[model samples]
Target: MAYVITSSCIGKKVGECAQVCPVDCIQEGEEMFFIDPDVCIDCGACEAVCPEAAIYPEEEVPEDEKRFIQLNRDFFHRD
Candidate 1:
Protein backbone atom coordinates (compact mmCIF):
# COMPACT_ATOMS: atom_id res chain seq x y z
CA MET A 1 0.00 0.00 0.00
CA ALA A 2 0.95 3.62 -0.35
CA TYR A 3 1.69 6.16 2.34
CA VAL A 4 -0.78 8.60 3.93
CA ILE A 5 -0.07 12.05 5.30
CA THR A 6 -1.87 12.60 8.60
CA SER A 7 -3.36 15.62 10.31
CA SER A 8 -0.05 16.38 11.95
CA CYS A 9 0.93 17.92 8.66
CA ILE A 10 -2.03 20.25 8.57
CA GLY A 11 -0.94 23.87 8.58
CA LYS A 12 2.68 22.74 8.91
CA LYS A 13 3.48 22.05 5.26
CA VAL A 14 6.97 20.97 6.16
CA GLY A 15 7.84 20.02 2.60
CA GLU A 16 10.93 17.89 3.04
CA CYS A 17 8.95 14.75 2.22
CA ALA A 18 8.01 16.02 -1.20
CA GLN A 19 11.60 16.88 -1.92
CA VAL A 20 12.77 13.31 -1.39
CA CYS A 21 9.97 11.46 -3.12
CA PRO A 22 11.42 9.59 -6.07
CA VAL A 23 8.14 9.42 -8.02
CA ASP A 24 6.97 12.91 -7.15
CA CYS A 25 3.78 11.51 -5.62
CA ILE A 26 3.69 13.99 -2.76
CA GLN A 27 1.82 17.18 -3.57
CA GLU A 28 0.95 20.41 -1.81
CA GLY A 29 -2.68 20.92 -0.96
CA GLU A 30 -4.48 23.89 0.56
CA GLU A 31 -4.00 22.72 4.15
CA MET A 32 -1.33 20.07 3.88
CA PHE A 33 0.47 17.63 1.60
CA PHE A 34 -1.02 14.52 0.06
CA ILE A 35 0.54 11.40 -1.36
CA ASP A 36 -0.98 10.27 -4.61
CA PRO A 37 -1.36 6.58 -4.04
CA ASP A 38 -1.59 5.87 -7.73
CA VAL A 39 1.82 7.37 -8.28
CA CYS A 40 3.59 6.50 -5.01
CA ILE A 41 6.11 3.64 -5.21
CA ASP A 42 5.92 2.70 -1.46
CA CYS A 43 9.65 3.37 -1.26
CA GLY A 44 9.37 5.18 2.14
CA ALA A 45 11.67 7.98 0.98
CA CYS A 46 9.05 10.55 1.86
CA GLU A 47 8.34 8.98 5.21
CA ALA A 48 11.98 9.14 6.18
CA VAL A 49 12.30 12.81 5.42
CA CYS A 50 9.01 14.06 6.84
CA PRO A 51 9.93 16.44 9.66
CA GLU A 52 6.57 16.08 11.37
CA ALA A 53 6.36 12.30 11.12
CA ALA A 54 3.08 12.70 9.36
CA ILE A 55 3.51 9.98 6.76
CA TYR A 56 2.64 6.34 7.32
CA PRO A 57 2.04 3.21 5.26
CA GLU A 58 -1.64 2.63 4.53
CA GLU A 59 -1.81 -0.52 6.62
CA GLU A 60 0.07 1.07 9.46
CA VAL A 61 -1.78 4.37 9.74
CA PRO A 62 -2.78 5.08 13.33
CA GLU A 63 -6.44 4.32 13.96
CA ASP A 64 -7.35 7.80 15.13
CA GLU A 65 -5.61 9.36 12.15
CA LYS A 66 -6.71 6.85 9.53
CA ARG A 67 -9.06 9.31 7.88
CA PHE A 68 -6.06 10.94 6.28
CA ILE A 69 -5.68 7.85 4.14
CA GLN A 70 -8.82 8.73 2.26
CA LEU A 71 -8.05 12.41 2.51
CA ASN A 72 -4.80 11.87 0.69
CA ARG A 73 -6.50 9.79 -2.03
CA ASP A 74 -9.42 12.16 -2.47
CA PHE A 75 -7.11 15.06 -3.19
CA PHE A 76 -6.18 13.50 -6.54
CA HIS A 77 -9.64 12.62 -7.76
CA ARG A 78 -9.34 11.29 -11.31
CA ASP A 79 -12.89 11.95 -12.46
Candidate 2:
Protein backbone atom coordinates (compact mmCIF):
# COMPACT_ATOMS: atom_id res chain seq x y z
CA MET A 1 0.00 0.00 0.00
CA ALA A 2 0.95 3.60 -0.42
CA TYR A 3 1.78 6.08 2.28
CA VAL A 4 -0.77 8.71 3.31
CA ILE A 5 -0.16 12.12 4.79
CA THR A 6 -2.42 12.94 7.74
CA SER A 7 -3.94 16.03 9.35
CA SER A 8 -1.13 16.35 11.86
CA CYS A 9 0.91 17.73 8.99
CA ILE A 10 -1.53 20.60 8.46
CA GLY A 11 0.13 23.98 8.45
CA LYS A 12 3.41 22.20 9.03
CA LYS A 13 4.72 22.00 5.51
CA VAL A 14 7.94 20.46 6.70
CA GLY A 15 9.81 19.22 3.64
CA GLU A 16 12.08 16.63 5.19
CA CYS A 17 10.03 13.78 3.78
CA ALA A 18 9.84 15.39 0.41
CA GLN A 19 13.58 15.76 0.42
CA VAL A 20 14.03 12.03 0.91
CA CYS A 21 11.36 10.62 -1.38
CA PRO A 22 13.09 8.95 -4.32
CA VAL A 23 10.03 8.82 -6.55
CA ASP A 24 9.12 12.45 -6.00
CA CYS A 25 5.66 11.29 -5.11
CA ILE A 26 5.12 13.86 -2.40
CA GLN A 27 3.12 16.93 -3.39
CA GLU A 28 2.51 20.17 -1.54
CA GLY A 29 -0.97 20.55 -0.16
CA GLU A 30 -2.84 23.63 0.99
CA GLU A 31 -1.36 23.01 4.43
CA MET A 32 0.42 19.68 4.67
CA PHE A 33 2.03 17.35 2.13
CA PHE A 34 0.30 14.58 0.23
CA ILE A 35 1.83 11.42 -1.22
CA ASP A 36 0.43 10.36 -4.57
CA PRO A 37 -0.54 6.72 -4.18
CA ASP A 38 -0.03 6.05 -7.85
CA VAL A 39 3.48 7.48 -7.80
CA CYS A 40 4.71 6.34 -4.40
CA ILE A 41 7.10 3.43 -4.64
CA ASP A 42 6.03 2.13 -1.22
CA CYS A 43 9.57 2.77 -0.13
CA GLY A 44 8.52 4.08 3.32
CA ALA A 45 11.10 6.84 3.11
CA CYS A 46 8.51 9.52 3.80
CA GLU A 47 7.34 7.85 6.96
CA ALA A 48 10.89 7.50 8.17
CA VAL A 49 11.70 11.14 7.60
CA CYS A 50 8.46 12.91 8.52
CA PRO A 51 9.07 15.11 11.56
CA GLU A 52 5.39 15.12 12.45
CA ALA A 53 4.90 11.35 12.05
CA ALA A 54 2.07 12.19 9.69
CA ILE A 55 2.95 9.52 7.18
CA TYR A 56 1.54 6.01 7.43
CA PRO A 57 0.94 3.04 5.20
CA GLU A 58 -2.51 2.90 3.62
CA GLU A 59 -3.48 -0.26 5.46
CA GLU A 60 -2.14 0.98 8.77
CA VAL A 61 -3.93 4.33 8.76
CA PRO A 62 -5.73 4.84 12.06
CA GLU A 63 -9.49 5.23 12.24
CA ASP A 64 -9.36 8.93 13.06
CA GLU A 65 -6.75 9.52 10.40
CA LYS A 66 -8.40 7.40 7.70
CA ARG A 67 -9.54 10.47 5.79
CA PHE A 68 -5.99 11.05 4.67
CA ILE A 69 -6.10 8.01 2.45
CA GLN A 70 -8.86 9.58 0.39
CA LEU A 71 -7.28 12.98 0.70
CA ASN A 72 -4.04 11.71 -0.81
CA ARG A 73 -5.96 9.91 -3.54
CA ASP A 74 -8.11 12.91 -4.36
CA PHE A 75 -5.17 15.25 -4.53
CA PHE A 76 -3.79 13.31 -7.49
CA HIS A 77 -7.12 12.23 -8.94
CA ARG A 78 -8.02 15.87 -9.42
CA ASP A 79 -4.78 16.51 -11.23
Across 31-70, the per-residue lDDT of candidate 2 in tens digits comes to: 8889999999999988998989989999999999998899
lDDT of 1 by residue, 1-79 (tens): 8999999999999899999998999999999999999999999998898889999999999999988989889999957
User: Considering summed lDDT, which 10 consecutive residues are worst modelled in model 1?
Assistant: 70-79
- Candidate 2 residue runs with Cα over 4 Å from true position: none
Tell me the deviation in Å of residue 39 in model 2: 0.8
Model 2 TM-score (2 dp): 0.95
> What TM-score, over all chains together, does every model reach?
0.95, 0.95
Residue 46, candidate 2: alpha-carbon lDDT: 88
